[model samples]
Target chain A: MTSTSLNNTVPAPQSTPSYADIQSIVANDFEVMDKQVFGSLNSKVQLVMSVSQHVINAGGKRMRPLITLLCARMFDDNPSEKAMHLAAITEMLHTATLVHDDVIDESGQRRGKPTANATWDNATAVLVGDYLIARAFNLLVGFQSLPLLQVFSDGTCDIAEGEVLQLQHQHNPAATEEDYLRIIDGKTSRLFMMATQGAAILQDKTEYMTALGDFGQHFGNAFQIIDDVLDYSGDSEVMGKNLGDDLAEGKPTLPTIKALELLKDSDTEGYEQLRIAVQTGKTPNAEQLIELVRSSGSLAYCKQRALEETKLAQDALSTLPDNRYRTGLYQLTELASARLV
Target chain B: MTSTSLNNTVPAPQSTPSYADIQSIVANDFEVMDKQVFGSLNSKVQLVMSVSQHVINAGGKRMRPLITLLCARMFDDNPSEKAMHLAAITEMLHTATLVHDDVIDESGQRRGKPTANATWDNATAVLVGDYLIARAFNLLVGFQSLPLLQVFSDGTCDIAEGEVLQLQHQHNPAATEEDYLRIIDGKTSRLFMMATQGAAILQDKTEYMTALGDFGQHFGNAFQIIDDVLDYSGDSEVMGKNLGDDLAEGKPTLPTIKALELLKDSDTEGYEQLRIAVQTGKTPNAEQLIELVRSSGSLAYCKQRALEETKLAQDALSTLPDNRYRTGLYQLTELASARLV
Candidate 1:
């Protein structure tokens, strides 16, 4: 629910550069960052390490860390390992949220992998998630940057608040697009903002903070929006996604929120069915509800919104620097937007 | 399990001081600290506020923060408000752990109050708990003391690891008393250390840290031992505590661990019943098992160990200022040990 399933699995886009291409732009940094994500998890408790390593192994894309790597390179080609370390912290934080999200959603599997909750139990998942978050801050404090700690700590609060906000709106049919924006703003975009802005703070590139924030926020919004739209229209069978998982969880994502808005007057019975599905979370009519959302021109609206966010993200990046790293960020947004087409 | 039920309930002793008596020594700081605990919770999300306030409202005697206030005043009769602020943060961290503990335990009530998990649900409980944790760190960072942040971040990691250690040892009949000590050291005593040491750090009383640490550790150990001892021998019928709840949950507390050791050679059948109960977390013969542990002289041994720890805590206080605050600290340990009598 807190972008737990928002894996950076960019769908087919013949024109845009791929995720691997962007990651390769900072391939060396990514290698170090990937190792540090595992290395930084120093826990005497075997269960903490085992569960953390398992989840980090299955962690999707390392997308946020890659953003940090790219941003660091954008500022200084030979930025200190601090950027890589910070990138790793961002991934750890993201993984922590995902672990808790699985517990909350009672999700057995995520992105074709069994979740920590499935492998162990909700209690293990919850505690391990807590360890990851605590360890992240512990490592962040080692950097001796008050600003770094401030942003990370504040971002963490936003992430939790965003998650709670999503919970508040769960099973709520009246949740608005504004409410959806606010939710993603915290749960999803806030970390993305941290990934880039953290690198800026580390490299003494404080001047670029605002632009990096915009880039991270809009890009995050685009990524999450694309993921939510896929919950309805993606090749769920091939992806192994139980279609309408979000709706079944009564997660009033943008697709559901917008569909309810578009269909409020056009098709009262269809609207009523979708509304009840969200409110009750008894998605006996899951297929029909998904189809109703898909046909209500809601997916089109969401796709367009995702593109607008992508464009805004690219525009924000243009204000940062002109480099292969910046281009990589642009392509990353294009890759996210590519999923819709 | 992670000291979630260590409610700091000081049992009867006419000579030893009462909890209210010790708290009254720092009554002003306690009042300010209490308000800060509620005031510092500034989540804009209504649910975060609602759940956080509910849990904070239900938070027990706030034993840890009282340690902080006393430590601060012992160093400086009028220490800065930072001490009070840090005290509040400790309580916040404690409440956060309790909220998650309820979720992990699937507990409906804790200390005779409906838990956040029971009042709302696990999802809300979990995310709100996360928010409380993040919020605590967020406020801690406001202190601008890197060392303070370092200790807190490190303490938080230890807390989580302690909890995971508890979960790992759960349902294991082979768990040792040493393992029990390590579990409580992290889950229960670590925060106590933080409560005392954090105030010393704030007051620039660097010399007192070692003594404060010793005091916190021993007092915490004594407090937790008394609580576990009560599980087997306390008036469960009147206290609303279900006897053998720890055994039913397969928690390897000192009483169960010691009982297992004591009866293994002396009473094989009784030992096997306790062993099976621990391993399976099923106590069909709960009353008999509680009686066995009680009669095996395990509680007496535990009570003796608790008194020894209480003496060590009082000894630690002798190195610090010998004001009423120090007496408050000494009396606090005496009150805890008095429960054993």
Candidate 2:
């Protein structure tokens, strides 16, 4: 765990680490944070417990909290228990957003598991999501750090705004790349920035904040772009979701926006088809639309963009202290970019 | 504004003041707080602005903020702009809860106006409601008072728990009067408590915190009780909702719970009818069910309970320094109870 051992154990930049590789570095902290995520649900209401535990348990790769844990250790080797608690709060907030998102999407399953909305009902999901959000803030107040509260509160507003903005742009083929970036920055990257920057604030490593925020934001953007690309190109069985689920929902992700842009001049028929699909959310030609987007050279363009963002994210991390934890963070961005490949 | 003037202007307990009469006392402050409730929604996202403004406009009474403003002035007549801001934040939180509640209840019209969920969609309403909650917390963090944040955050958790608890007891004929009280205490009274107690915290009037909280809790209980009573007894035109709406939704409010308790032994046929209504929420005998609840004497019992709660709330004001603001608060409680009469 010492700096020397960390440096010797760290891999060179050429090889990307798996998520497990990064997590192994902070295995103990992850265990405690994982427990705290459920332990924090002290609601006397049984339904709250059942729905909250279901959603939290159904959560995807605790990446946000993992980032928080890594960043906390990147500053001080032996960070306080507050770091683990804050990490748990981040996961709780993430879970709350997911529960609400499932309700909004009216999705029956996520990550191959039934959603809270599906398992219980919309009312149950919404209220339990609310309980998680409230409890997260309730615990954040326990930290008694106004600066921490400010970062989180502000970020939460941005997150909500981002989700709403995406809804606004839904079915609009004219949505620009800038709009896509703005949406992802809010809905995805903002929490990442909070996770890393929050660690700096909690550890009194304020000097590292700007760098950490940059790392989080760029990585978040890259992560989301990869996710969008995967929606068009990844294995449907592996994703546990059909291809173009976003398009079916009329979501204007970067791939769709970029495809529309690239197709407008050269292929009017293709442009009209995809544009109308985005507009009406009716995919009579689902396979053709997927093929149209893939054939439009937009996926390649998106992969290039994802790589650039990943690079920027890694570059931002170069400013932080060179340590095992920092290496773990660097590997995380690489792992995310690897998804693009 | 002074104690002497307050005593002279105060009406006898026998006559209750209307909400408007109480509001007129803080007319200027109320105006500014009303503007702030809209002004605080400074979301750059156009959709967010639209939905937030729509819901806030559809909001009823602005009672919570009024409580906040009154409590603020009661402690310090020259309360800071932060007080107005806090009052607005309280209203925002209240609106957020209502928006989510509408979604949970699948309500179409509230107060004779189309709800955000009805106008936009459940997705939009859920996200915008979330935005309001986040923005409220963002503003609360601006106060830089950990104690204030503590009060609001804790109260928020209680509110969510209460809502979930209500959901837990839904469609259960056996839901008790105690369960009903607990549900209202969390769902309705907690915010009222926060409204008054938050004002005390911001104004550094810690000594009045207990009294303000007690006033808020009891008043909240009374307000909800009257609301439930009205669901069965009040004019649909005045209430802007149907009689037996609670029973239709399978919500076991105080009136229904009490009615079932009262009819279980004395009127077996009435008891089974009402019990089936609550359990099934299939009110084919809607009129008969309403009649059964009415004849069971539960509305009168609920009304008496409401009166007792109102008296307790007014009595809590006795410890605070008597002034016009205090009188305004006392009259507010009386007005709530007058709904029963």
Candidate 3:
């Protein structure tokens, strides 16, 4: 769709591949992982099945599982069924988090579709989310590999802690960049790290764990930073969420945090206004605040930082064998960064 | 405390022990398990630690962990530190469920203490509940026993499914007694079974798993049935909740289900009133509804049924080695049944 360099070091691609193009690299594996996500849900309870299916079906891109699938193949070309199953588990865990996040955010819609909490009551959403988590662990135990269990269980805890850390920082306008990184690292990157390293662990490619983990973490950081940037700059119609939704929710994302820092010295009035908005979650001047952040040059800094993280992620991949799957992953980071342009 | 027969077959004790008295049989184990419940929470996230501590401290009876401690000793007189850790994990899982339950139920207080959802927001409660579940599994993985992971994971899935099943049956007056058993079996009994069987698994005493599982399931059934009975008969102040709270929530527990059946024949007018109340959850004449169920002889039947389950639980214990811990577990069931009188 568009041409961009995969990284500053790599030559510019003739054309940037779309997500579908990247997914097609592992087309058969992607299809199986997608099916297993729904197939693995074996709940005797009718409500559990219905709610779990609704949320999982509403999922976006399947990026985390794609990462898992790609990483599994990078280690072993003919990865076993366990790799596909593990990939499905990653998506299930992701869906579980989204289900609870909707309940927490009191969101009615996600990606133009109604949320589980919106379709059912909060009670159904919460319990079904719990069921998904339990079911994921139950399926993981079927592998009988303690190492696999250890990676997943430990990653899940970090994901939860990351979510809690985000809550702790909510409404605190003074939240620093370090605080933001810690929160996203726990909530966002940890799962990505798990997705990458999990395959290595499953394939008994323990030696590749560190490189895979670094690839995951840096890629995750880039992904979340790009997402935060889009919250300020992307089209509401395209994104299916309003601009400044994070600010209105008092979530101190990078744009708002950096904007606050940039405005503090240059425009004290603008600084106080944004700070109050963050503190009270009162976005009466939502349009004006968006403009202020845009004019403050914060988005440029955020894009630059996202690009830096993307570069580091691609660097980490250099240690692994060069293959189509690695190129797919490289293109993924570029695609995520392309959103910034 | 009131005295009750331990079972129809066993000779009645001179005096039935209270829960505290039964817990005193393994007082040292109970103390360590209690401390470890707090100590095992090693989250760097301040919010996680605070909310986890709040719910754990507000825990009622620590009965599940007590069951675990007692079962551990039944196999090995000198259980290792792992037993205490496992027992603590049981409590953590129990607390995790309670935290989410509060959010689902929108409960303001539990056992006279403010709930995590009530004290913090639902977001914080949901995330921390997740953290606890993950932390429990993470700790379980540390044991490096796939069998232990299998039992805990299976039981956790059942617990969540049971919760969803209860939500499905809510406000449905047509729910049958069988449906009630299935619901409580998942939501209540599964954890009890896990606590008992987990100890046997950890101690390498697979021979006793079936008996221990039966003991835990029946005991959990009796405990839940007795709890339902008390919702109609216990003191509001003493129970820390209003009488007929379950009816208010439109939960068709055994009392409500059985009463609907009995009243349909004895008094058609009374049957319609109860049915409407269950359907609408509009219990304006709450006392009258309580009276209608009481006069229909459902409470007596419930108490009789609870006694039957308690007897079955004691019968399961016949296969296990006779020891003070066995006596302690038997007394624990007696203590639960005593609440009925």
Candidate 4:
């Protein structure tokens, strides 16, 4: 439509394109795919269709589905209709979970606007999310790859499990890094892995399938760490949600957990204060605690770990043959760990 | 051990197998297989194992998983270890969804006991449910059948979808039998279908797998109808929960919908009162309305349809080779629909 779009579509982004550049390519696919998926949601039942449309039209970044498309394109030039269908499905699954998460969190806002739960009742939010998921399965059945279905299904289970695991770990200072990893693996990385691996399954690329799975796993962990860190340090307006909502809810995100572990021995007063805050669900002074973590270098420590995971993600990509999209995926790892707001 | 225990290498009910006989038989395998699958949960993390155990021990009827186990034993002489593992996974998945359901439903009690949300917190309830689902996948991986995993995974998605769909239909008097069927299929039948078909997948019987799926679909529909009827007619103590909780929650159960449809012309005053009660979540003397439905033959009408489904369930068994467990499964379907209390 625009000159820049024409230029990019003609030659594609260069090898190892920047995050913005990659997003531009994905934007095109996202728009087309969304229309296709949601369009098919039309039904004879007006309420079912209307409610489904309201939920679907809410808009998402479609990052997970983008990864799926990028990975499929990276491994092979000739992608099938199944790859596109699976890509759509990946987004649908992700979106379905988001609506349910809103209900579970009881949050009033998401993506800078009222969440489905907040706009409608929790009942509609629940049903719309369900319709999206069923529609996803109905679409995935088109792929006809039993293994792909298995992988995606397993990922969904992992996502649910991860959310549940995190729920149990809340307000408990004893929550370990291992527990944190398990939670992220289930909640975050599992879907990332499914998205990429599902692409591989569709492409029938065995060798790259495992590698893509690893890439998604590491990248998802890195992405979640950045999200946790941003929760503590970033601007609420830019991030599109309240800062420290997780902490207020008594969730032990990476920064808080690591900071608590660091201060366990020396700063008894600080540690006890933080523990009391978690129990009472009132951070005595939110900004002061944020500043303390910043000064203590725990945020920096988490950032470094996130960067290391980025390296692991890049290393996982080495199994695939050289291609522009592959290199773009490698750069995506770095972009994920980078601070945006 | 008692003489009855010696006869089965397992504990038998003191009152003998009666109302929930087939369910009890299935529950035995469920407990054993869950312990086996969750053994890994203990090796890695002691805390999650304990928390998960506490949640699992909270007690449920094991309806969905029982259907799976019964279906498995129906087709084959001795169900495979994979079948047992899948059965556990199915129950865990059901439990995971239930815990989340309480949070969404804001339910104070489940099965006549305080809900996880009431006992701990919404966050904890959410996390524990997630943990159960995660443990389910961990268990599922042992079977390593992608098709099997896919079926269960799709089931999970459907479960979530069904919950959402039912939420959308809440308090909408116009919600049709078709709408209710779609909701229950996602909520109730999807898992039931998965349970039976998952077992069939393990047995490598494609033809019977389809038949078993249909059997679960019909039986599940019938089971949910009975459950809805119990909400109106059954004693709270015997049913293990309050009789009118569904009405209080504004859930448009089948009997209520049917009752509303039948009473449209003559009982305008009563209907308006019913509508107000649902809106305010207050029970405004349900005796008259309940009696009206009882006399008008809607309950009996629903019961008749349930009986028809049971016949369909029994007819499905003809597709598979005859076995004692198969006959037991048929009996279980009749029991599910025929029970008054």
Models 1 onward score TM values of 0.95, 0.97, 0.97, 0.81
**Which lDDT tens digits does candidate 3 get at residues A1-341?**
11123243344688678899989988999999999999999998999999999999899999999999998888889999888999999999999999999998999999999999999999999999999999999999999999989989989999999999999999999999999999989889999999999899898899988988888999999999999999899999989999999999988999999999999999999999999999999999999999999999999999998999988888888877667787788888888888887
Question: Positional deviation of A331 in candidate 2, in angstroms?
Answer: 0.5
DockQ of each: 0.85, 0.91, 0.91, 0.24
| Candidate ranking (TM-score, best to worst) | 3, 2, 1, 4
Model 3, range B237-294, lDDT digits (tens) per residue? 9898889999999999999899999999889999999999999888999999999999
For each candidate, the alpha-carbon lDDT, in order, equals 0.90, 0.91, 0.92, 0.71
Q: Please write out the lDDT profile of model 2 over residues B1-341, one tens digit for every residue.
A: 33344445576666677788899888889999999999998899999999999999988999999999999998888888888899999999999999999999999999999999999999999999899999999999999999999999999999999999999999999999999999999999999999999999988989988988889999999999999999999999999999999999988998899998899899999999888888988998898899889999999899999989987887788878788899999888878887887
For each of the candidates, the C-alpha root-mean-square deviation to the true structure, in angstroms, is 5.4, 2.9, 3.1, 6.9
Tens-place lDDT per residue, model 1, B13-49, is 4677778989999999999999999999888899999
Taking all chains together, the TM-score of candidate 1 against the true structure is: 0.95
Expressed as tens digits, the lDDT of each residue in A40-119 for candidate 2 is 88988899998989999988899999999999998998999999999999999999999999999999999999999999
Considering only N, C-alpha and C atoms within 3 Å, which residue pairs clash in candidate 4? A126-B164, A127-B164, A127-B165, A130-B161, A161-B130, A164-B127, A164-B130
Question: Worst ten-residue run, lDDT, model 2 chain A?
Answer: A1-10
Please report, as a residue range, the 10-residue window in candidate 3 chain B with the lowest summed lDDT: B1-10
User: Following a full C-alpha superposition, what root-mean-square deviation does model 1 have from the true structure?
Assistant: 5.4
A213-266 in candidate 4: lDDT tens per residue? Answer: 888899999999899898888889988887778778788878878888777787
Model 1: runs farther than 4 Å from truth?
A: A1-14, A237-240, B1-14, B237-240
Q: Is candidate 3 or candidate 4 better by lDDT?
A: 3
